[model samples]
Target: MPQCAIITCNNTHRRTKGGNVRYHRFPGDHNTRTRWLQVCGKTVPNCSTARVCSRHFSKECYERDVQHELLGLPSRCRLKKGAVPDTNLPLDFLKEEVLPGSAIDILLAVGLVPSQPVQKVSGGLPRE
Candidate 1:
């Protein structure tokens, strides 16, 4: 997934010049980056266009993936020792890549980790 330099506010009515929003020519029906097309053999209305599958994907899935990635970033210990983090890898790849007790659920399941701290809406360390 591509990380954006700007973070958008949660309120849609409030507009700003930042967020992960982007524009690319996507297939009209798809909402994800999957390599498969919606129609098995039938081509898209426009010939010679390949697109990520959007039909099966929902906004919730996207959000879940995003949350998983965000949570995973701080959980991975290998990145804490001043090494370059592997957070750049694809979310699917990260899910499949095996490292012992590295997954969030697994870490919690074996009682090897504590719950993540709750996020506050405001008033913490001043932004640098």
Candidate 2:
């Protein structure tokens, strides 16, 4: 679950207002352009925007976001018993799969790359 928090300042130190916080679940890459825009609401005219996480966004100011960002997760920490699968598989396995070369093609098609580099490493591909 992706969480969102609205920053607020009370009499003392600022904090994330639980009332304004919300959670969302997405079915795609978090960093994808569409994903960010979908999660981060439209920016108010002349207002600033910042995303604390993939689905949580703090707009207009950073204080409110910081309150929760610096703190811990929402009240309930771990997932409830039997709430979700207990598989130990990496998270990536659930995301849409793309062929290795397709990524390069997509990157180039998007003008992110004009050309691919072929580097010459010492000693038959230097050891990592």
Candidate 3:
């Protein structure tokens, strides 16, 4: 029941309906592991337990050989070397709820927009 290491991703090898999902471990090589960390934006010191499901990768990441097809192999496939996860952004970033307030109010609550009144110049342009 290996699950994706990404906090936002919910894909798991065990929950896949038809065993189509594949899980991959972090590379053993130092350089490759570093690259994986950079691509995945993870900072865990030990990646031995970290697993990434195939949904994080593009279709081109998997191997599709004639032998695999002939053998009637499960859809669980191995990823190509040097492959990076290039799938869509995780579900967490897609939330789109609108708060009941003016745009400035929301900005002020988040400390994004300044509260001070900006003085306008003679030409109606903001003074630097």
Top candidate, metric TM-score? 3
Candidates 1 and 2 compared: the better one by lDDT is 2
Candidate 2 residue-wise lDDT, 1-128, digit = tens:
22322132021112433444333232234344343343233432221233232112323212244445568644332222222221222344335675466776878777897554566577667433
Residue 19 CA displacement from its true place in model 1, Å:
8.3
Tell me, what's the RMSD of every candidate? 20.9, 17.6, 10.8
Cα lDDT tens digits for candidate 3, 28-85: 8788777667656546666998888778888897777767678997454777787766
Clashing pairs in 2: 7-64
Poorly placed runs, candidate 1 (over 4 Å): 1-21, 27-93, 98-128
Output the worst ten-in-a-row residue range by lDDT, candidate 2: 5-14
How does model 3 fare in lDDT? 0.73
Kindly report which residue pairs in candidate 1 clash with one another: 30-54, 31-54
Candidate 1 C-alpha lDDT tens digits along 1-128: 22221121122312323533331233233333222222222334542342222222334323234454767752211111111112233344336555566588687776788656766557865444
